[model samples]
Target: MFIPAIMAGGAGTRLWPLSRKEFPKQFLNLTSDQSMLQQTLARLEGTGHSNPILLASEKHRFLVAEQLRLSNVATSQIVLEPFGRNTAPAIAIATFMAASESPDNILLVLSADHNVADVAGFQKAILKAQALAENDYLVTFGIVPDTPETGYGYIKCGDPIDDNGQRVSAFVEKPDLATAQRYLDDGKHLWNSGMFMFKANVFLEELKKYQPDVFDYCQSAFNNMQSDHDFHRIPEDIFEKCPDISVDYAVMEQTASAAVVSLDVGWSDIGSWDALSKVLQKDENGNNLRGDAIALNTKNTLIFSENRLISTIGVQDLVIVETKDAVLVSHKDHVQDVKEVVSTLRKNDRNEADSHRQVYRPWGHYDSIDNGKRYQVKRIFVEPGAKLSVQMHHHRSEHWVVVSGTANVYCNGEKKLLTENQSVYIPIGAIHSLENPGKIPLEVIEVQSGSYLGEDDIERFEDRYGRVD
Candidate 1:
């Protein structure tokens, strides 16, 4: 049986503003109504695969679960890494888990953030890789290059093997324009798609052979994993000792059993705004406009507006993205350099680099609408049947006014049912909790008054989400 292992942990810093560290691009609906991660799971609907094993970060566990629930993808396991140790360790843990179930299980490892336009072609490649995998070959799907693109790594194919697979000759890093052209001319190189298929035992054996330290560390971490609800938490200390490296550096490049299956499916990692623009529908002027965006005399440009109108008069070959708190305007040629902007924001300790004004929580989300030196205002939304932690603030007092639906609020051991336009006040140091008692989402406007109005001021006494700190 094929067990899909979806690697869903990535910052996706290149697509910032819209994609934050807390909420990355994989969770965003870039192409269709479903998110990239959801789309990744949906594409395997008819592929006769077992429930997927999702690997995500601890901070993103709720996002992964929520997205999967929305997509109706029942996950076999949701492994939570305390910290990222790169693809090598991530894949090793997943392989270990799958092998525990059955050593002969074929694992179809895929990144949750990729976009494959041709689902049929992708499934066909998987079938071919499965055949090669059954023969104990570590198989990777190599995309047939259509252009001399330097952004992606290239895989050089060797002599053809059985079942339409080729022995992997060598893995090459991203090259310059001239070298990329040379590789394209050679016709022996393909873009490294990072999608792989292999029997669980075969991959584990290769990993143990090529990089024993990574394998050993990953095994130790997985063995000591703790289960919390849907999340399987890996021991942070042991996993942190694992060397930080990619799978290519750890095993695939060193293993002699590595093989590549050429895939002609249209695939894009959507690494930048330019890549997203290429996949999206373009207007007569070659402009891809989304949300409340208007472009005039624009050619080969992408404009994405989330909460406000973004209008361009005469821009060409540009990407303009406006979110709640940040705006990114860059030329298409320089889209790859957008990561440097995120790096700069990090160095400055700016929160904008990590999240937006609106932050997602397990129960719901809250948007910071206004703030002052001694007060703050927020718009909070609570999903039906969800409740906030029973907690108290040390330095702030809160007043919640229900705007829609019904709110069951508990303040200072007093329970009250608040309907539309009704308000409640929780004094400083008073234990409080908010719940959505209605079938629909409960929207509340919150006004806070405090000398120190930070999120860290909350002291949780009880939480259903298993949050302790």
Candidate 2:
């Protein structure tokens, strides 16, 4: 049996407008009905592994918790990094956590946002790698490449090993078109998939030997960890000192007992629009159309619309994605340059670089429907048994009309229960709170009229999420 640790912290810049810094690709439902994170959790089933230990950024704590609750995964062992220090420190922290359980337990490391079409093949490869891990080998699953793809690094395989695996002859960086073609022709190279397996203690020792400073910093941060809600947060100042490097550089490249298992599982990282288009199902014209899109004379294109109907005419080799706040139109060949748009947006202090029009909170979510010079409208959802903080706004007054279920409104130390079609007014500077006391979800339409309608105008008195003292 092995323990799984899923790394979920990443900024998917190429998939912007749909994926943001606040909400990345892992939390998106790109392929199926479930999100990639939920699918990763489901991938653990039938493998006889323990519940996964999720590692994410501190800002993504609620997202991690909500995904776990939605998937019915009973794992509360989430480790939150202050900020991303790359994979080495993250895996080091996970290794230390897993070692606390048992040093001999194998830890299978996986990314939370990878798409694998062949689930059975992936499980089989995991079993193969676990056998090598049992023999003190640092095993990484290498994807058998079908095409001369230059986006990924290649791994050259040596002689066969004991567990249907091969010794890793060398790990090569991303190659040019000619080198990639040569590697494909030689048939001795595999794409580095970044999935690894080894005993918890064995990985810790390898990390300590090669990257000693990183090892020391991660161990110190882990010793100073704090348990908050359903997550474990490493201290910010200490974790920041950990080197910003990947596990491939810190341990895998320097390890002596490295092994590679050939896996042909139809895997894709979904890194870019072109990569995502290749992984998704396509029509006869080689087009993948999602969500209220109508295409005419379109071929080799991808159109994704999140809100309204998007009709395209005479488009080829293109990607057109429409979100509530922004839209991205680009040629498929230049999809990798989309990150330049995100960089420009960030330089201009644009909120679109970080968030969507709809924002999620610990309680529920709210969508901004309309906004004018002095008035803004929001469609708010409050989950059952969830409550907003007791706070007062200095510059805005809110009018809330309950559209569904029930609401308990507390304003200025007075409480009132409101049902469907009922309304309540919260004047400016009135200490107020809202809660859903019923078993069903409560929906409300809130209209705010104020000189300043920004989100930073509230002073909290009491909060359940530890946002305030």
Candidate 3:
């Protein structure tokens, strides 16, 4: 049986203003109502595959589990990484874990942030790769290059290894525009999709051959890993010492067992706004827009407006993204350089580099709709039967006015059932917890007034979601 290893820890900064470090693009509902990660999970259905193992960062552990829960995936398949060490370490750790169940099982490694339009074509390619993987070849899915796309690395096919698979001659880095055009004209290169299928033991053999140090590091870390409910907690100290490297550099580039399968599916990594625009349908004016937007004379532009109405009078070949906390407007050609914006924000210690006005917790989400000096107004939503941590703030006091549903409020040592329009005060140093006691979501307007209204003021004493840290 095949086991999927979903990699979901990328920060995806280039697609920012909507995608942030705290909650990346994979979790966002990019193509439809479901998130990219959820789509990835759903694609595995009816494939006769075992439960997937989700490899994600510590910050996203709960998020990953929650997404899988929404997709109705089994709970035992989630793995948590304390820190990101990229694909090599993650794959190594994952293979080690999979081997514990069965050494001969094939692992299909898929990135969570990708978009595949044709699931049948994808399944065809995966089945072809599975055939090669069963024969001990480490197989990678290579998308048939439609154009001179310099954003992705290319795989030069050497010769036919199987009836449907090709021996990988070499992995080429992102080429120049001219070279990429030549590659497209030659019809011998394919875009590296970063998706692979291999026997767990074959991958481990390659790790031992090409990257023994990484193999040893991950093996030791996995051996020492502890179970945290449904999550597998990687030994932080040991896992952190593992080399920060991608699977391409650490194994596939050096291993002789590498093979590539040509995939004709419409696949996209959705790395930048331009790439996302390509997947979305365009309007009469050639504009791809979401949320509340009005484009008067826009052509070949992607506009994503949230929390407000965005009007574009005469924009062309541009990407305009608006969130509650930040806005990004850039030329479509310069979409790759959007990472520089995140870098500048990081240098200036701006929170926009990390999160948006709406922050998603394990329970639900909170949106800072409006704020002022010494006062901030937030709309908080708690999922049914969910509760925030029992915590106390040292400097700030909060007033929670229930807007809908019912809330169980714990302020100081007093507990009260607060329904719609009921308000409660949580003064400074008073331990409080907010719970959704109703079937629907409990919505409230939280107003804070204090000298310090920073998020760090909270001292959590008890948390049901295991977020004591």
Top TM-score model: 1
Better of 2 and 3 by lDDT: 2
Give the per-residue lDDT of model 1 (tens digit) for 352-452: 99888999999999999999999999999999999999999989999999999999999888899999999999999999999998899999999999999
The lDDT, on a scale of 0 to 1, for candidate 1 is: 0.93
> Against the unseen true structure, what C-alpha lDDT does each candidate score?
0.93, 0.93, 0.91
Candidate 2, superposed: residue stretches over 4 Å from native: none
| TM-score of predicted structure 3 | 0.97
Model 3 lDDT, residue 388, Cα: 97
Per-residue C-alpha lDDT of model 3 across residues 1-469, encoded as one tens digit per residue: 7999999988988898789999999999988899999999887787889888889988898889889889988858677888889899999888988899999999999999999999988887888899999999999989998889998999999889868799999999999999999999999999999999999988998899888889999999989988868889898989878999999999999989899999887889999999999999999988998999988977999989877998988779999998878889999989999889899999999989998888889999999888788999999999999999999999989999999999999888789999999999999999899999889999999999999899989899999988786
Worst 10 residues of 2 by lDDT: 9-18
Tens-place lDDT per residue, model 2, 242-262, is 899999999999998899999
